[model samples]
Every structure is written in C-alpha cells, then in structure tokens.
Target: MSDKPKIKVLVVDDEQDIVDLLKYNLEKEGYEVATANDGIKAVKVAAKFIPDVILLDIMMPHQDGVETCRQIREIPETKKAFVIFLTARSEEYSEVAAFDVGADDYITKPIKPRALMSRISALFRRESKKEQENVQVRIKDLIIDKTSYTIDKNGKILTLPKKEFELLYFLAKNPNMVFSRDELLQNIWGADVFVLARTVDVHIRKVREKIGEDYITTVKGVGYKFD
Candidate 1:
C-alpha cells in the first residue's frame, strides 16, 4: 500500500468509454476519481468533489472545455484545482487558448494511459513542492502569498489563474530584475512543458489586466520586469 493520500481526480468527457477507462486506470493507481459526461455536468461535479486535478475534454456539448474551465475558475470551491485539457485538436492555437482560460496543462487526445498518469503525478508533485514554500511578497498595494496561492491588491483579492499568479509572483519576488520569455518558461513551466514563448506573453497580458498594467513593464525586444 502507498503511503501518500489518495488524490481526487475528475474526468470530464462526453465519451463514456474514455471516461470509464480513465476512471479505471486512475483508481488502480490509488486515486479517487469522478466522471462527468458533459461540460455542464462537469461544473456541478467539480463543485461537489473539489478534485485535486481535473482532466477536461475540450470539445463537448452544452458548455465546451474553455467555458467550463472559466466557470470552474470563478467558483471559489473548485477554482484552485489544477486543470489539464484533453483534446483531439493538436493545433497551437487551441493549446494557447487552453492556457488562456486557466488550463495548467494541455494534452492531445489519443494519449497513452501511462503518459497521462505520469503527467498527473508530476502535477501533484509540483503542487506539493509549491505548498512547502511559504514565501510572501508585498509590492505597493499588491500582496502575493505563495503559501495561500493567492494575490490581494488594495485589499481586493484577485482571482487570477494559476499560471498568471505564478508569473506575477515570480516577477514581483525579484523586484526590478528583467526575465526573458525563455527564462520564465524554464523556471515556471519547467523543461517538459511544450509551449511557445508566446504563451508567456498571454499569461503576462492576463496578469496585467487583473492587477493593473503598471505592475508589469514590458522591455521592448528584451523581456518583462515588475514595476
């Protein structure tokens, strides 16, 4: 028997066979798994289960993965769960869109069960490590708390996605130090993340929009630094 506690996972896909297969394999790995047949159902299930990870299918009836993920982020109960998108569309645009809407990871469909399991395991491990670091930074009226995985601006709590929060926290922690896009990717997402430099821009845009534009200064042709 494994000593680690069971991590809850929610599988959201319209295809019944895929959901069953995922649930079976995840259960065998000693994870607590739940299923939802559509995006609508996924929201309700996620609200109740509050899973540690969510395997969300992109194309689905009623809500679609992007919208569903956004809704999940809005919900305080499930907003913190790590979301991984599962889709047959391997286009870069789709992957970018997934990240734009708060997906922690994106995987093309027809993924091997073992590979999926590995990704999930890695995500959990990263989250665990993050929890161990209780660093907090305060810049002006903004407060970035790594321990709570939250940011507060002028006493207003900002509901930022995971990547956006991490990006902001990283830049803010170092104060005026400028970091290139490649450096941000390597430090934040690690080597295994298959995302382009443009993805960093997308996350930066989101962070700026939420926390105000002056928080991040773009150093044309160089990179970005926290103002």
Candidate 2:
C-alpha cells in the first residue's frame, strides 16, 4: 500500500442502490467511503466525517441538496470540503445556483463509474498542485495568500467564501491580464468542471461587491482584468 493517506469521500443520495454502488466502487479505488441516504443526514454525516469530497444528490426528503450544501458550508468543520452536485437535472440555471452556493463541481446523473472516478482523481490532483504553489500574491493594496486561503485588503482581512476567494486570486495572480469568462471557468473551476460561463459573472459580481469596484475591471464585450 502507498504511504499516502486514503481520500475520504461521502456519497449522498436518496437512492439506496446508487449510494451502495458509489460506496462500493469508491472503496474499490482505495478511497475511504461513507454514505448518507438523504440531504439532512448528509449534513450530519459530513460534519462528523469531514470528508474531502461530497457527492450530493439535489432532490431528497426533508431538505434538498442545495439546502444541505448551504448548511454544510455554514458548519466550519465541513465548510471547506469540495461539494459536487450529482443531479439528473441538466438545466443551466441549476448549475448556476449550485455554483452560487459554493459547489465545486456539477455532474449529471446516469454517470459512468469510470468517468466519475476519473473526475474525482482530477479533483485531488488539482488540489495537490494548489497546495504546492503557496505563493502570496500582492496586487496593489490587496494581498492574496494562497497558503492560508485568506485575502487582505488595505490592512484588513476580507472574509470571502471559497469560490469568491478563488476567483479573486486567479485574477490577481495574473495582474492586468484579461481573462474571458470561459477562460476563467476553465482555469479556476477546473477543465472537467461542469458550469455555465454565467457562473463566472455571478462570482465576479460577488467578489467586486466585497473587494470594491476598482480592483477588477470589466473589458467591454470581452471579459475582466485585475486593475
């Protein structure tokens, strides 16, 4: 066995067969697995297990996946865990809402196990690469510390959610370089991530709201750049 610690994964769905299948296959791949049958239970299980990734179903009894994700984000213990929405719904609006509430990725149902496993592996590899590059980027008065996932603006620390912080960091990293929404989505959200380009707009609006207007400039009909 490799010396690296096993990845913890929590599979959440109301469908028992689906949950069982995911747990079995994930365990087969050497991931430490856990399962929850509904959204409410998912929150409790996630808080306790603190899994590195959560595969959440959108529709569930008592509470829905969006609500469950919101609750999980609020809980400090599980807030940073990567959330991937596993839904049958393929609507663009649903994807937007998922990203709005801190979802890291979205996947449509009837997914092949092999494809899902590949995506999961990619997520971990991306995270490992991020960990290795802990360079602190200072852009104007805003300081982005990739190591701590913190942003300091004008001597005061700004409280930003994971996605918002990531958006800011990506733009600030390449200061003055323009990034189209598609490019931002690919770079920040990862190439395998399923999200609409509008998701970048939503995150940009939120980031500008917190960080002030002057830092990020919108290039007409193109995209945005860190000013």
Candidate 3:
C-alpha cells in the first residue's frame, strides 16, 4: 500500500442507495468514506470525520444542504473541507444558492459514478499541486499564508472558508492586476470545473466582507483587483 494517507470523504444524502453507491465507489478509489442519510446527522458525522471532501444532497429532510453547508463551514474542523452539492434540483436559483453557501461544485444528478469520480479526482489533483507552493503574501496589516490557509489581519488571526481564502489569496498575490471573472474562475476553480462567472462576484463580495473593501477594488465594466 502507498504510504500516503487516504483522502477522507463524507457522502450525505437522504437516499440510502445513493449513499451506498458513492461510498462503494469512493472506497474503491482508495479514499476513506463516511456516510449520513440526513443533514442533521451529516453535520454530526462531519464534525468527527473531518473529511477532506463532502458530497452533499440539497433536498434532505431535517435540514437542506445549503443550511448544512453553512453550519459545516462554521465548524472549525470542517471549515476547510470542500463541499460539492449533488442534487436533482436543476434550477438556476438552486445553483446560485449552493455557491452562496460555499459549495465548491454543483452537479445535478442521475449520478454518473465515473464522471463524479473524475471530478473528485480533479479537485484533489489541483489541491495536491497547490500544496507545493507554500508561500505567503503580506500587504498592509494583512498576512495571507498559503501554508496555514489562514490570514493575520492586524495581529488577529481570521479563518475563512476554503474558497474565500483562496480568492483573497489569489487577488492579493497579484496586487493591482485586474482579472476578469472568467479568468479568476479558471485560475482558482480550474478549467476542469464548470463554475458560473457570477460565482466569482459572490466570492469577491464575501472576501471583502471578511477582510474589508480597502483590499479588493471592483472596477465597473472591468473585474476586480487587489488594491
């Protein structure tokens, strides 16, 4: 067996068959897998499992995936975990809501296991490459550390959800350079993942909310830049 630790995955859905399908495939791919049939239990399981990735269903009983994702992101242990919403809902609003709650990817499903596996692998592959660059950026009172995935703003350590941290770090790294929404999505989310351009706007707003507007400036008719 490889010495590398298995990547842990949490599969949350109200459907037992879907859970079993994902659990079986994920384990077969050498990941450690955990499952929960409802959002309530999913939160509990995620707190303890601290999975590297969470596959969540949006329409579960007890609570929906959006709320569950929000709660999970609030948890210290799971804040950095990647959340992907796998739902049957195909509405544009559903997709927007998923991204608003910090979902890394959204997929409407007949649940093609092979395609899903590829997407999951792609996420890990991108993350693995990112781990090689252990650099930090300092501007003003803010310190963005890629190694710890945390920010020090005026000596107070602040933690952001994974995507928010990455968006801020990326912009901060290339200060004063304006990047269009499509470019940001490609660079941050990668070409393999299909994310809406509006997702970039949402993330930018969120990063601003956490770190203040003085850092990122929105240029009308253009995109955003780190000020």
Q: Write the per-residue lDDT of candidate 3 for residues 67-126, one digit (tens) a residue.
A: 999999989878878888999988877887887787888878889989988888888788
Query: What's the number of clashes in each of the models?
Result: 0, 0, 0
Instruction: For candidate 2, write residues 1-227 as lDDT tens digits.
Output: 58998889999999998998899999998999999999889889988999999999988998989889988988877777899899999888888888898999888998678989988888878878877775688879988987667788888997677788888988888889999998998888899986788899999999989889999999989999998
TM-score per model over all chains: 0.92, 0.94, 0.94
- The candidate scoring highest on TM-score is 2
Worst 10 residues of 3 by lDDT: 126-135
Global Cα lDDT for candidate 3: 0.88
lDDT of 1 by residue, 88-143 (tens): 99888888888887888888888688999988878778777766765789998988
Using alpha carbons, what is the TM-score of model 2? 0.94
lDDT of residue 138 for candidate 1:
91
Model 2 misplaced stretches (Cα beyond 4 Å): none
